[model samples]
Target: MLNYLGLPIAASEHAGEIDHMISLVHWLMLLMFVGWGLFFIYVLFRFRKGANPRADYVGAKGKLSKGTEIAIVVAEVVLLVGYAIPAWARRVQQFPAESEATVVRVIAEQFAWNIHYPGADGRFGRTDINRVSSENPIGLDRTDPDAKDDLTTINQLTLPVDRPVLVHLSSKDVIHSFGLFEMRVKQDAVPGLDMPVWFIPNRIGDYEIACSQLCGLGHYRMRGFINVKSEADYRAFLAEEAKFLTQ
Candidate 1:
């Protein structure tokens, strides 16, 4: 159904549910437009000057218009309570356990994305703002034992397909939005806040990540890529990155 509407490809497990909700809302909106428009045209023709030369002081009394308004209100109520609420609850409240999922941290800045991996030990290293510089974007404490194996990358995210992945998202200077359309995942990266987004990529491919928020003069160039690879390939990529770490 989404393909017919020219929507983006569904690359993750949650894409189908999001597409379904969007289709429902659009279909209802279209139905309302065509249905109410025809009715309005009919009313205008029925009360034209040729039909009623003398105008009535009081408006014509009828229950049809009132009933139509009531129906619209009920439809919106059902869409909110039935569809929107459940979808949000399922995504935010039903996150998988960190131990059972591959965890990564995405730190957004003015014009780039910083991807951090906890390496083999599964523990993030310490980061300090005072140490931030052109060479060290995230200010990693290489002396810290936990940070010795941590890997950092710019503008690229690599994950294994068919596994639950959690991203701890944040921004360095201003607000940014991490938008992965194919995965149907979008979350704001706010400064001083750790927001989490989880997803399972079912397809192995490369997808684009756009900054949905306008940060500054360089917002237009804030682009990233997500590489969904097979489990073996993902492990190989991790090993390769680990070897390149300066620590």
Candidate 2:
């Protein structure tokens, strides 16, 4: 699982459920493959010319094939409606009310990612492209009172363990993919639109964040870290970030 190319399912919030579904599908496929393999081999050995030279193609178009086809279709429908649809719906469901979820925004540029926090007010500042500058690359609307209190952080992202987190993603230039392999979260960050992705971090560790989309020359350098810390450490980190932003 760790060596797989895609995101790891070990530490995901829905790891248990997702892994169960994945394993079920895998085992079903394995059984089908082995069963068909052995059946073909048995037929080959039993129907050899020396064994049964009289070729028998009787009942080749019998109701057995039709029943098999119907069974396959029914199985596919059941899996699609029962497993696939439900899994996807569960993935997109908003965080529960009992969980005090954290909201963070990620703005992707040509080669880097800019993270924004709403500060203590829980409201993001309006942004304008006309006011974009080197220091204020996100073009945050500082004239607004809400904008004044909003805190912006570049390259670094921190989350609290066992807390749900909703990340709003966007892009300033081309398309970029936001992915945290360890948490099994991946989404496309597109310009001119905001995409919302939510997840809960169950593990306390440093995870790698990378842009899975190939936008331009510096795409390879688009990388960062996700630190899932204890609640106390997360609060401390937030306090430190707030101070820096205010200053």
Query: Which candidate number would show the highest lDDT if scored against the true structure?
Result: 1
lDDT of 2: 0.81
Winning candidate number (TM-score): 1
Error of 2 at 72 (Å): 4.7
Query: In model 2, what are the clashing residue pairs, if there are any?
Result: none
- As a whole number from 0 to 100, the lDDT of residue 96 in candidate 1 is 91
Error of 1 at 39 (Å): 2.0
- Please give each candidate's TM-score: 0.94, 0.81
Provide the lowest-lDDT 10-residue window in model 2. Answer: 1-10
84-187 per-residue lDDT for model 1 (tens digits): 99999989999999998999999999999999999899999999998888888998888889999999999999999999999999999999999999999999
lDDT of 1 at 145: 97
TM-score of structure candidate 2: 0.81
User: Compared to the true structure, candidate 1 yields what TM-score?
Assistant: 0.94
The sequence of per-residue lDDT tens digits that candidate 2 reaches over residues 1-247 is: 4633242645558766666666667767787788679868987897899988788877447596677667767867877788878977876775444327888899999888898888778888898999888899899998888887787777788888998888889999999999887776788999999988888889888887899999999999999888889999998988887786656
